[model samples]
Target: MTDRVLSGCRIIIVEDDYYQAHDCKQMLQQAGAKVVAVTAIVPDLPDLLAEGRIDAALIDINLGHSHTFDFARELQARSIPFAFLTGYDAGMLPDDLATNVCISKPADLHRVVSVIAGLASRGG
Candidate 1:
């Protein structure tokens, strides 16, 4: 495992499901990415963004109480890139966002590493 590949990459995770968030964070941390924050709600997102530099994000399409598109827009406004991590199928995503890359739930650690590497390569 290369520790420096994702060095200094700040990743934000938004998932209402606590276990999933924990698991994802562990995977990301193991890959050498610094997880800035893991939040289950969007109201806290702006604050998190304000507090640090976010290079990329792993956002769940649906929080327990709401969807993440609005938060995605916020990230877009900041020119930060993000990928969706969802249990829901691609069909569940809005057409506009369906083109965005996503990792299905029960994501493989290696695949997650590869995806993050790809995102990093794109300067995400």
Candidate 2:
């Protein structure tokens, strides 16, 4: 286990997998982050964003039958740092998202914490 490196960071999880989301929430909380919301649908994100105070986001590339590319763009526009938590490789992503941070599924929780902590610190 890692230290409470994400202390005071507020985050959102955009993943459809119930077990993955639950595990991630627990891990993030243990690392000292406040998980503001967890949603499987992109359309629901606006309301979550409207509530404000999100430091970063951990988003899955594929959600049910759809993908989160456009949602990722919106997050970029809002200047909220985010990382893709996907089973796909970076080369599989679109050109625009290829440069963004990406963490594969079955990820190392400690490493995920470190990445989120860094993103939160950057604040965009």
Candidate 3:
């Protein structure tokens, strides 16, 4: 196991896949993050954010049938840093969100944890 580099971060995960979400949750937990919320739907995001402090987010670009650009906008507006985990290329993302981090699906677990940790450490 690695060091607890993400010890103080609180994260929200918005992936629609059951296995992927659970796997990601385990990875973050192992990295010492408190996964405040994990859901396959987008509607819960606003409520989750309103419920408590969230240091960062790992979002899947597609939530089964819906897209995530609008939700990402809200996260951006709230100053909560997030990165997309998608199978698609960067060109597939909305233009406004083009600059945000885009980690490919089947993500590198270490990279995912490290990116979120970096965002929290930077106070983003």
Q: How many residue pairs clash in each candidate at the backbone level?
A: 0, 0, 0
| lDDT for residue 87 in candidate 2, whole number 0-100 | 91
- Badly placed stretches (over 4 Å) of model 1 are 1-4, 43-45
TM-score of each: 0.87, 0.93, 0.93
How well does candidate 3 score on lDDT at residue 54?
89
lDDT value, residue 20 of candidate 2: 86
lDDT tens digits, residues 1-124, model 2? 5578888899999999888888889999999999998888875667876787789999999997899999999888889899999898888888977888999998777778888989999999
**lDDT: worst 10-residue window of model 1:** 1-10
* Superior by TM-score: candidate 1 or candidate 3: 3
Candidate structures ordered by lDDT, highest first: 2, 3, 1
**Candidate 2 versus the native: TM-score?**
0.93
Ranking by TM-score: 3, 2, 1
Residue 39 lDDT in model 3? 88
Q: In model 2, which residue pairs have backbone atoms overlapping below 3 Å?
A: none
Top candidate when judged by TM-score against the true structure = 3
Candidate 3 lDDT, 17-70, residue by residue in tens: 888889889999999999998888885566786788889999999886889999
